[model samples]
Target chain A: MTRLLTLACAVFTMTLVGCSESGSGDDTLTVGFSQVGAESGWRTAETESIRSEAEARGIELKFSDAQDKQENQIKALNTFIAQGVDAIILAPKVETGWEPVLKKAKKRGIPVILVDRGVEVEDESLYVTLIASDFIHEGEQAAKWLAEKTGGKANIAELQGTPAASAAIERKQGFEQEIAKHPGMKIIKSQTGDFTRSKGKEVMEAMLKGEGGDEINAVYAHNDDMALGAIQAIEEAGKKPGEDIIIVSIDGVRGAFEAMVAGKLNCTIECNPLLGPMAFDAVEKALAGEEQPKRIVVETTIYDQSIAADVIDSRKY
Target chain B: MPEALKKLLWPLAALGVLLLFNTAMNPAFFSITISDGRLTGSLVDVLDRATPVILLALGMTLVIATAGVDLSVGAVMAMAGSLAAMLLVDMQAHLSAVIVLTLGVCALAGLWNGVLVSIVGIQPIVATLILMVAGRGIAQLMTDGQIIPIDSSPGFAFLGGGTFLGLPFTITLAVSAVVLTIVVIRFTALGLFIESVGGNETASRYAGLSVRGVRLSVYTFTGLCAGLAGLIYASDITAADANYAGLYLELDAILAVVLGGTSLMGGRFYLAGSVVGALIIQTLNTTILMTEINGASVPVEYNLVIKALVVFVVCLLQSETVKQMIMRRRAVHD
Candidate 1:
């Protein structure tokens, strides 16, 4: 048994060494990517897009699934730094716990591109560039659409994302800022659904109970998951969701469009997660020392029930 | 009175002290009101959130009573909720009432845990751990890794949203479960048998008590509790995201059990104390967030750190060395 265990350990070590040797070539560009994990459809799509883009570019992508852990992502970044990768791409799980890692990467002269999510670091030079959707803009768009649909007089309940996530914080800020402009529109009750469908449903149920049936006119979810939950709560209360309570959310996922077409979802603000092509472009520019904006804001569009059917069929992710 | 009542004094005293501290700090802490005939505000929210942890702790109490632990209750909740969601996919409109669907699915998941721990003879921690990792994967797979929003389910909504006597429906369910559990343990000989088995499995078998049966029943009970929590969770959200339902709830439940003075080594149990313990934890979390003391600098994740500290302090107090030291100090002071 002792001999067998020794042999197994030896074999595993050799397999890893052999795998690394096979991929070590001069032409291959080593790109390290720290992902948030396969937590949602958006994340999976982002992963696939990154993989496909890396393959097409002939870049050796060192991918790490952080599993929604900041420490894991930090470890992965350090590992990439030690391995001396040409560039690094990170989709942070949360905003703040990233300053030290980014500073380390900057000191090492490895270009770090922020993808999908932004970090809360004071020094702008620590990161090469941020490639992400304008999260606050997405929230603003969702609120704007809801305001127009309801004629600016509506009692709204908000289902926010995970409390610490940068996306949730910015999205809430943007929505609140826009809604505050309209005196008639008020957020009657707001809660952190933690970007989970069940929490969204639970919070919405509580909101429904608190606000009374048919008292709420709209729900502005930070993401499609919460909007879907609000729809369930509304329907369970023996009311039509889109008619009785307009549902507007971010994350233009396939489900969001389907619901829009079915008239259950009122509108969705697109926050594109497919940042592979753009991220690659930023990486190439940073490596070549070309001038690039510190923050790259990806443009987004609002989708309503009218065009939802037409676009739902062709939606890639 | 009874020895059971005597056993509860410490926990009750701890609760009283904490409540006093809270009231002193915030004058409005004890103020609870009903608006539009419904309980509104932070107190109601605390009760609503405590429901899931209360159920998990109740089941854990029994598992610990058997000298074992189940770290997979949260995963079981995800799996049961996912299974129910999968079954209701096409039959969303035609499915039975929310209570039936939720309870039935949870029962099935509970049975799965019981079989693995009892029949397979796998260690309780290892068995539940497998479900913890795989159950979330299964839940994600059920929804095709997407968040499924369920609309038009009044029966489901009522499970989470409806109120009774100005209290949320979930609190009512939790209270009833506690009562039912108390009856089973106190009124029947099963509770005594379980304690005897937990105290010494070898001796329990030698005495002709069905040790395996007791073990199975404890895990099954935990599974049911987790299932009920899942239903309440799902009903509240009105949609199921297999990834996030009951996430990290096992930790909270464990913390509650520990806070109530129940030993992880397992021997006896305290169901009511555990419920209060769960409420205490929720209140602490709510208070921390409401104060808004720069969560970014001192992130909300520090709640886990605080929980670990509380557990450490309690476990230290439980240690013979600490107890002896305290007794020595007391004797000298007297």
Candidate 2:
């Protein structure tokens, strides 16, 4: 009985030692990353980039997938806090309902870095910085490109994303704002595609029939998937997609590049998902007690048919 | 009218009203135009888009008639699409192999639900709900959560976007499946067995019916139907998006079955009614998409509200109590 008791004590002590060793080390930075689940190709790419970047930087990343539930994210945040992680990187599934858990992390002096998405907290200090693409800017770039491509006059058929989505609303706002400057570039028809290829095709087909078949000259989709669907619809209608109805969309996914290469898509604005290097840079700055900006907008690029072929291979997502 | 034809009246009427409203709104709503050796128009679009819902409702009708509901049909669609995409694009497998393996896996998924419900004696809803929740996750795992775009499979594309005899291939597939199901169920003793089993499982068992086998067969058949629907849907988009493929379509199927006058409690089933029910839904969607009020597309928020109102009216018209109430009110007024 004494031997058994001694064995239990030794095991317990070793476990405690092991746990402490993993919890923190003098030189190693442990970042607890709460991801918003593998909801899409974009999200999966973001997660992969973050993981690889963490490995390259020699930082220990404690990863947790929230599987698209806000509750799971809050639970992950609490677990990271309990483990005394050096920093917390959260790609929140939703914008709201994060204040209380973020407050707890703030009290522990752990800087939270938002990736790909941001949170809505009363106190801006809850997160050190937000590293995300400017959706509205992407829309402006698309509109500016279209205006130039069409010589500042075109009938644009806008394919919005899911209604009420931040990306959809912001992109629409930016595109409309920029297009308003061009008096002849009118939005003839605007409809929601719900951010799916099937709906995009279906809605585009109806739009073509509702307006006379040859009325609209351009389609502005919120994402590449929708743009691709629109291409099919345009082809089915006996109209050349890229030539007859200039197709432009956001999200520089590989599908967009392929469409551009095939001469079906005119242009696509990049909503860059590779934020790992920049996110780590933010983490380092925050840990060193440097003041960080409230939001760090990742630089984006516009890809047209001219550059699509050369850049297609390098595009990750 | 025959009993079956009578049951289809409400759904057909509702569909007719929607079509009339659409024609009034857009003069080209019913105009079928020949383009690129195939039919192209708003009406054809409605039929093409209705393929998935029609297929799902066909299977859902049988399952519901067996006094069991399969909630996993939508998730099974995602699984099948994911498998097809992964095989065709990622593995670069042959189109025939991809089709066989995808349908096989979907049937097995249904058999899993059947085993849980019939063999283990669990409630059908809870048994099928297991797959409904986990099926999409399994699909995501297969594709590594990527939207697998099938860019080069013209042979497979024929299932979704090809034309046959100047008609959308999808429309032909849906019609053949519906007709085949009807012939198999109505001409054989299978339909009677299903209705008997659904009417009273204990009573059917007493009468020497293999209740377990009937339940298993119906669930498996439903799974097969969902697999075909998934294939068509993925092919339509030319990609397999595990996240959104057939998402919430199971509810649409259930609504279709109900709108076709199938009771939730089970017993009677209507195959043709279910097809019309599916058409009603697709027509509603196309109408909403085509309708432009004040030069702006109809608010999507009102789409479901209008659908619900139409469904409610159809159900009310089919209700015996409601019919009696209306008749009594009319007589009193007279």
- The interface root-mean-square deviations, each candidate in sequence, come to 7.1, 1.5
Error of 2 at B243 (Å): 1.4
Regions more than 4 Å wrong, model 2: A1-24, B90-92
Q: Report the C-alpha lDDT of model 1 over A250-311, residue by residue, as the tens digit.
A: 98887788889889999988866677999999998988899899889887888999999999
Scoring only chain A, what TM-score does candidate 2 earn?
Answer: 0.92
lDDT of 2 by residue, A1-317 (tens): 99999999998787657646766657889999999887677787888999999999999999999888989999999988877788999998889999899999898789999987888888999999999998889889999999999999999888889888999999999999999999999887788888988889988988998845468999999998888888998888899999999989998888889889999999999867788999999999999999988999988889999999999887666
lDDT of 2 by residue, B1-334 (tens): 8989989988898888888887788777888888878888888888899999999999999999989999999999999999998888878999999999999999998889889999999999999999999999898888877788887799888999999989899999999999999999999999999999999999999999999999999998999999999999999988898888899999999988988888888888999999998988888888877788877777766767877888788889879899899999999999
Relative to the true structure, how large is the alpha-carbon lDDT of every model?
A: 0.77, 0.89
| Residue A205 displacement in candidate 2 (angstroms) | 1.5
Stretch of 10 with least lDDT, candidate 1 chain B: B289-298
- Give the CAPRI class of candidate 2: medium
